[model samples]
Target: MKTDLNIINICLSDTPMQEFIRENRILGRIISAIPEIPFEKVKIGECIRKGREDLLYENKKTGAKHTKITIEEKCVYVSKVLKKVAEEHNSDFLILDGFLHYFNGAYWEKIDESVASDCISMAAEKAGFLPVEAQQENNKKKLLRQFIADYKCPPIQTKDDDLSISVNLRNGTLKYNNGEFTLRDFQKEDMLRYQLSFDYDPDATCPQFDEFLDYVLPEKQAQDVLMEMIGYCFIPTRKLKLERSMMLYGEGANGKGVIYELVKEILGKEHVTGFSMAALSFDANTRAQLSGKLLNYSSELGGKCNPDMIKKLISGEDVEVKTLYKDVWTMQDYTCKFMFNTNSLPKETEANVAFFRRWIILPFDVTIAKEKRDKKLPDKLKKELSGIFNRVISGIKRLLEREDFTESELVNRTLEEYKIRSNTVLFWVKKEGWFAVVPPENTERKSAKVPHVELDFLYEKYVAFCKKKGMHETSNATFNERIRKLFYVQTGSTNNATWVFCDKPKEKDIPVSDDTQSPKSYVERFIDNLNEEK
Candidate 1:
């Protein structure tokens, strides 16, 4: 009754007879036919009852069927069952059943295809079906991304070049002054912060440029800078090595608030959030909403922004961030450029030199009166946003044509004053008449000897200034080292370490010589030589 090769007994019979019998046997032929099944007819298990016990649970209080079940719990049980099947059959993948859609109290409901894909891909590695070892990378972010990408799904957009990668304006393309770069890697979620629409407006017209008006910036340089800010939001931040962030400062009504409001209108509420610099540094889960945002705006920045955040963003570093209920830290690009409007500057950060590189301090000098000011200015600005967007594109063109852009005199003066005030050591060096002041013999009183200062004496003044300003004082060794780097540290014959001016040459002024190098010793030696000659 059993099917076996022995039924034919080919070895015992003649060769011709054995061969003929073997050809006619059912087992001798390859599988030439397969039954086609209807799409709705197929099922992994006959009903929901056949699934794992974990899927069927009752709520403790409400007694609702399957109320205890959750995505997090169901995913674990599914991975175990799938992994067992994969190991037994050596299967690379499985066409999972429709049961994984969602658990609605008592039964499953269908979900979006993307959600289904995410559920499957997330459990792939733990199921041991993912060939991650072969790829030789274990980073969680890359691994998760690669698994989803490698598996077939609905294609949104594909981008291989990281640097060239940019947010798709949904306009189908991004046009610079010189060329057009089509948008790629257009993820709908990523654009949650791009809130501003860069949709090309062929019919949109820019308002006329007017001189002596505070509504739209009248100055060419100011106008160019504003364009760059708007244009960059459409482009990706990773494209530039360095960026300049703006801080618009002036009196009560210099149109700082209007400009800030205009930026918010252009970039929607979802894309632009009020950045409380103080709270941002201290608050938890602050970065959660900022993940996809292109710009962080603050109109009423009261004091100084945090230095640590500023330095990291300006340098294009990956910021370590966390959100509510998250156990692990996620790294996000500090791509969001900050725009601040305030009546005054905040407290100066200790690292003044590095901070100055990224800071663009612009004074809003022009103020408009009640009649002269456009009450409906914000509404008008919104209508012309598309035109302004194009203007920014043109600004990019100018930047490329000339390697350098405008730095107003106000910008230069503010930076110089910032450096002198914020930095304790630099202030003393400049004020000390080229790092050389005559040392008084008596430490008890003021020196009438000469109008110069000594290195040790200058250090005392530096420390006092820092304490009075509530700034941290560096160690004597560190202070000495920093000054030595700026100028020459002279060691006298007596093994006394003296400081002398380095006399760094410059174009504007003739280089200062080290006139106070020997001090009274030089004068004494000249007098002795004269006496010997007499």
Candidate 2:
């Protein structure tokens, strides 16, 4: 309900640069969706702050210390400012555009964090709605999604007894008696959300990935990985919990450019942003200019070596210049889904979490490509990709409606179908269920005799771990045994056991088969089939 309300109330807050940021295709697309909310872009005061320090000496012989005023003045020049620009446009949320900074990646040290949080919190408190932190909000979203999925709500409209309208929020598809709804009058936001699913492979080397790689060296594996990386751009509005930024990696000449090209292709010319860190080092004026626009767009900018600049850009809080231009620019704040393709070092430190969460890291590999192509992406591949993209969005929508699964669990379960993990089976079993690690059948594999989660040993061990970490105490609902699908080691018994295994079961864990065989193999088989089809 709160999310729905937020969706309805989406509008721009009083932050400068909001318009320019929103005008970007990605942000614009999100704003265009969710028509219930009004949005407007205010013409902002363009403040250009110049930082220059001149060391003056009164008397060279006297050797006296001189006062140096670090005068970095920000002159706010108004240009046809619009009041509450975001709200006027009927948007469901405000999109702020700003920069943040971190040192060695430890904590959020932004000039605007406190002020922005205070303002938003105060407003939310007055409105009896607290602004949700990303972590907390994720939990809430997960729970709500699960609730909605299982909820058997009556149709909003029912015509004949044989026909009713059921809509899947994931794909924004309406079903009339289980049939696709013919277009009558459609809303733009819903369609965009449905269309703009983010599900590409930064390492794909196929048409989906190779679409961009065609310009670079061509190889099948590289193309496939690239395709996977690029596919993620469109899944967010469908509620896919994707990382906002990406890190494309591989050796040199490995089609890294190809992967990045995929990003440029879908984000459109206007939305794809670049940053140039060297520009700031060039001069004071250059540093000032780089402050407002997207940094990743600069042709000269490369990710691996520009940690400081990237950190500054993402945090939207504080940026420091060490040279003659020791300018402290307080950036505007906003939520942006940042995508970065790099060869190495993608993790953000504690200090950069605010900015870190805004990014979804993607890696690229050129050497893995199987073939080289010089032409544009084939029409057939594009068509396949279009369908796959839609399916991915729909899958995410369904995923969001499930229980508030842990982020790890979400990753494990969602990626299970992708075969992204080679050695593990994502396992969910009740305590009373047969075994924790069920080895495959007829392969000289036997199920380990691990006790259920409620057993004395595991329960005590887990409780101790939770206590040591000061985590919340578990309740009956929290006893489900959820495990990532990873490659397991063969234990003494017929079956191989894995560390970090769970024996608990939740209400949703379904039981199967009269025989003593573990249901895991069946589950794996189903997933394998699905992957084969893909």
Report every candidate's CA lDDT: 0.49, 0.34
Clash statistics: count for each candidate: 6, 110
What's the CA error at residue 77 for candidate 1, in Å? 15
Residue 438 in candidate 2, Cα distance off native in Å: 35
The best candidate in terms of TM-score: 1
TM-score of 1: 0.56
The sequence of per-residue lDDT tens digits that candidate 1 reaches over residues 1-534 is 344667555433433422432353221121011112221212222225466445455568997454343233333344444334433432222211211222222111233343434334333333333323212233333333333333322222324243443333435434333354344333332322242455656456566322323353556676676666655555555555446677887886677777787777766666676776664554546744455566778776645457777566545566656655554454444466677787766655642556666777777767777776666767766667677656666655554455334656666566555655555555545544342332222233322243333467657877987788676677787677656544445445124545443332234354434643432242333223322441
For each candidate, what TM-score against the reference?
0.56, 0.29
Q: Write the per-residue lDDT of candidate 2 for residues 1-534, one digit (tens) a residue.
A: 998788756632423433443454433433233222111111111111222113332447886434332111100001001112222433222111232211111111222333323332222222222224211334334322332232223123222343322222223333332222332222322312122222333233344533444445343433333333343333332233333344444455555554355445444334345644445423334444333222233333343334455554444434443323334443332222334444443222211323333433333333544565434543334434444443333333333444122233323342452232211112222223334343333234334453322233444554565566444334322332222222122334323323322333444455633542354564555456444541
Backbone clash total, candidate 1: 6
Best by lDDT: 1
lDDT of 1 at 224: 73
Q: What are the per-model C-alpha RMSD values against the true structure?
A: 19.8, 23.2
Model 1 per-residue lDDT at 110: 35
